[model samples]
Target: MDCYKKSNIEDLKAKNSYKIDLLDYSLFITFFPQLIAGPIVHHKEMMPQFHSLLNKEKALINWEFMAKGLFIFSIGLFKKVFIADSFAAWANAGFTLAQNGGTLNIFEAWVTSLSYTFQLYFDFSGYCDMAIGLALFFGIVLPINFNSPYKALNIADFWRRWHITLGRFLKDYLYIPLGGNRVSKIINLRNLFIVAFLSGVWHGAGWGFVIWGSLHAIAMVSHRIYSFLAIGKSFLNSKIYKIFAWLLTFNFLNIAWVFFRSENLSGAINILKAMFGITWVELPYKFKASWLFREIGGNDKMVGFILISFIICLCFRNSIQMLDNFKPNIKNSIIIMLFLYIALIMIGVTPYTEFIYFNF
Candidate 1:
């Protein structure tokens, strides 16, 4: 907007730009698929599509796109209602315990942290999937937003995979404007830190969010330094080294999520304490949440779900992959129908839970 408002006619022509009518600008801003949460699309990406659609193209909806969009939307609904919300209960109970000054056993603490971790993965992945699907319904293809970020072997790679469009926006707008990697190493690192810090603030206005950003910044900067030094570059190809690297990255993200999920600093510390083997059985308000898995009568179901979900997150083909390999057969149609039917039933039967990004 500033570019259009401030640029002279010559500058506008150079970029193949012109003033946008208010109606089209509003359409761009209010595109329902990404209005709330987004893939952070650019004007160039959206405007041309809008112009084409308005010029007698809007009526020509591609049946193939509509079918694929519904399929993707159904898959996303299952991810949110069935998978993400299933974990939300455990995560919420654990955080509530800490917030109320209740303590937790080490097992409970780990459960809480890991619950939120997986919950977040599925929740956001579902939202972006739905956004992409909905856009497809209108014959518009939004960018890929999430891409198995938990499978990343390093913090930098995590950013590359997770919330991909947001990362792209930051890299192009903030990181580059702050000099990007072309600058001196120190300044480059500083730019990196600034991008991460603003990313934290973007999530919410809280100290815990700031700390979450700081933890990520530290890890990213450390990784950058490691890469700069080129330590063990040759050994990095070994299976053992790769496994060690993956473990380090995954565990770091899991721990960092405690701060992100906590209601306050003290709550985060208690969970961290228990996670690291400090049992919380002695606190004044001991964490006695028999309801933690009351419906299931134990943590067995939760544990199994976490493991299976983790494996799926790590090993299964993502939605895009499935879509690419899609074949319209009786089996595929039946699966999609089952997902939609189950999701609709859940929506009608269960209490509503907001999407995680709703807070953001």
Candidate 2:
């Protein structure tokens, strides 16, 4: 509402000074492609484009743009249908096992957390890609939302990469309005906490969500303090130090995901207990020989998949990067079409699964 009001006021001020059509203004607010899960378009960015005569003409019959949009959309569909949905079952099973009085062993705990981590990432990022691609088909360029967030070495860096539009909205509408860094350090910390807490609550209704948000808040505050003290400056500059920092940030994110995925506070605590080796059980030989072996085998596959995803996220170019350097060639088109074919087949076989961010 605040963002809307601010934009509305600015638009009215501009209208009084210069001529602008109402249809363009309406389209700027109701742009269909980005309406579902936003890259949060701003009026200034969108309004000018609506007035572009060249863009309007090009959008009607741009074969090159259409091909690029299709390619990007195919990748997103593959990510959501083939990869994210594959992990959903494993994640659900792990969490359900814990809730059903089954002991959540260390392996199960990690598997559940990791599955959900990848699931959420691919699911949300996939949607973002599709939205951006759709917008491009209409000659509209929405802001990039995901930028290989798993590669981030610190919590602060993670926020910058992940759900970038939402972060921008919060920074502009909440943090800045709350005095931001213009105030004393203590007040700045207060603003951070409030924003984080609201962010958590905005995700869902639960104490686990609050705790997840609080965990991030605490991490951000600690990072700020560390920066102020200039602690371990030399270490921070080293490659080895960056690897350690990435590990720490990634693990912290996984831990918070446990809370986010859990049904309740106790459910989250139980998973955390299993993760930390505070829960244990001994199964009979027959049971261990049969079900335990199968479970371990499944977990091994999941671990392999997670590691592959991590590599892709950390070492390879993201969708946006690929799109930027894209060249439409026969070989590339064939590969993309093949992937899209597989994704369509998978979609046929799998039951429909909603993107994780829909609830938010």
The number of the candidate with the highest TM-score is 1
lDDT of 2 by residue, 65-109 (tens): 677777888888888998899888788877777666566667667
TM-score of each: 0.89, 0.88
Q: After superposing candidate 2 on the true structure, give the runs of residues whose Cα lies further than 4 Å from its correct spot.
A: 1-22, 53-59, 283-300
Model 1 has how many clashing residue pairs? 0
Collision pairs in model 1? none
lDDT string for model 1 (1-360, tens) is 111122332332354365688987888899999889887887766776666666765556977777778888889999999888888888998888887777776777888889999999888889888997898889777777787888899999999999988999999999999999899999988998899888888899999999999999888888899888756766888888989999999999999999999989999998898878775353325334344433222366787888998898899988776776666677878988999999888888767889999898
Instruction: Give candidate 1 regions above 4 Å deviation.
Output: 1-19, 56-59, 280-298
- Model 1 scores a C-alpha lDDT of 0.82
